[model samples]
Target: MLISDSQKKILSLLADGEFHSGAELAEVLGVSRSAVWKQLNGLESLGVPHAAVSGKGYRLSRPIELLDGAKILDHLDEQHRAKISSLEIHDQIDSTNTYLSSLARQNAPSGSVCLAERQTAGKGRRGRQWISPYGSNILLSILWRFQHGPAAISALSLAIGVAVIRALRRLGIDKAGLKWPNDIYSEGKKLGGILIEVAGENEGPCYAVTGLGLNLFLPEEEAGAIDQPWTDLGRIAGGRPIGRNQLAGELIDQLLKVLTGFEQTGLAAYLDEWREYDCLCGESASVFIGAQQFDGTLEGIDAQGFLLMRDADDRLRAFASGEVSFRRAFP
Candidate 1:
């Protein structure tokens, strides 16, 4: 559903979790009381929780920290802020990755970043839908150009995963860890995910769009479609308040730093950190590549970022790309 500017204004007005009467809302929105009522009702279609009372006006079920480009930029230092070529904050979109990819094709600068408060068709790993409700979580994508070829940056996604951990660590969240290939986990539950799309010459320059979808205040109503056990930063932080804008800025800073230097350092600089947060080092998980599935003990990734595993026959093998699914402990 496309959220109109008036709907966005209404959401902003009620984002404080405090009620605003019809007359008050109408006055601020410069619309009639009935138009204000219509806008409020439209929020329900976007899965924005709101309530109204006879005595009071309307308020969201909870306060939402909407994406603000200025606030995010404020959290960054002058160096990093200057490095960003452009920052776009969308009220809603299909997918930030797709959005930036188009811009990249149009010769968008390397440090261009895209953030959305909600994604109607968010992309996920292995062709899955990334379910994110309006004003519920962080949806970020960064566009960066690389001097190295695809092979040289084979482990780029894992390196980005390490950057994600660093950003979370900056928030005093030490519970976060990596579930290899490209997932962020905390307390054995999925916390976030990463997707990197690259396009360029075979051995020349390339540009990659790195997308991150992290859970913050995920409502149960919008999470029913998710198949795996999941936890948001709210739960991982032990119900403590997290500064969404600050977190966004931190993520951009860390991820861009990695992207900028990735060509010179490759993955060597990031390999150790990735190993430190490797959650499935010795876990027996199911790895799927297309129609085939391999059940084995994950032995961590190799220097080139290939996933290493020991299969049932005690044979060691490496996979360049696939889906990793955590299996339950044997009985």
Candidate 2:
């Protein structure tokens, strides 16, 4: 069930483990006592049962076992973890990236994460619609600010792909592979995608919002909305529902570790690691760059992260940016 900002506020207040009188909550939230009662009852209906004492008011019967922001913070070392200034979770949103971008404009600190259980209008690279069902997929965005130029920021997506693949491997999804700039694949099917947006001057300090949408378990009814073959972590992990909050925390930690290095050396520093997990390399593929299309065998990415290909005439060509589709070529 979706929880509103007001409900979240009430939950936060009750999270202290002390009985907060209904009048006190109403005063704090600027609502009537009756309204508070209604909200509390709504929460109870949503499986968050609470106890109401005649004089003391309402208290959660049990602490919310949801993701622990403090615990995640405690697990990280001082340096990398300290980058995060805030972590906000939403029950529903249009898009995590969109929400984070709005916060970035207001100068929200870097490493701020805005996550949602579902996104009504999630999107991927080139404005492709992302499938986001409630409680079944991860829809999150991390706000990062860099002092580098836009040219340097271009490789950030690729760098983040490496981080996602590493995190998935940690969860025992070993066959995960990255498809070009930002798609994560398993068994030749897409498992997740990364979308990045930047705001600021071309060369000055820039804020990049990196959004991640990962399928944990796809609802059967909603699975048809996905255009291509796709798989979820639940299937790969033997029907275990990965704790979304835990996965988010781990992904953020690893991403910060990687992005710090990337900001210094660009994609060149991670070339070998990227190649070790390359999914399209050594396969025949089609590169769509504007109106011109080329069919070639995937060689490998160059030092600067450009896709390298060998054409039918055995001629070599390098593509920097385009839509690439992989397939097995018939001899």
Candidate 1, residue 269: CA error in Å? 0.5
- Candidate 1, 186-272: lDDT as tens digits: 867889999999999879988999999999888888899999888899988888999889999999989988988998998889888
lDDT of 1 at 96: 98
- Can you write out model 2's per-residue Cα lDDT over 18-66, one digit (the tens) per residue? 7999999999999999999988887754445679999999998644324
TM-score quality measure for candidate 1: 0.96
Against the reference, the lDDT scores of all candidates come to: 0.89, 0.79
Segments in model 1 whose C-alpha atoms lie over 4 Å from true places: 329-331
**Model 1: colliding residue pairs:** none
- TM for candidate 2 is 0.78
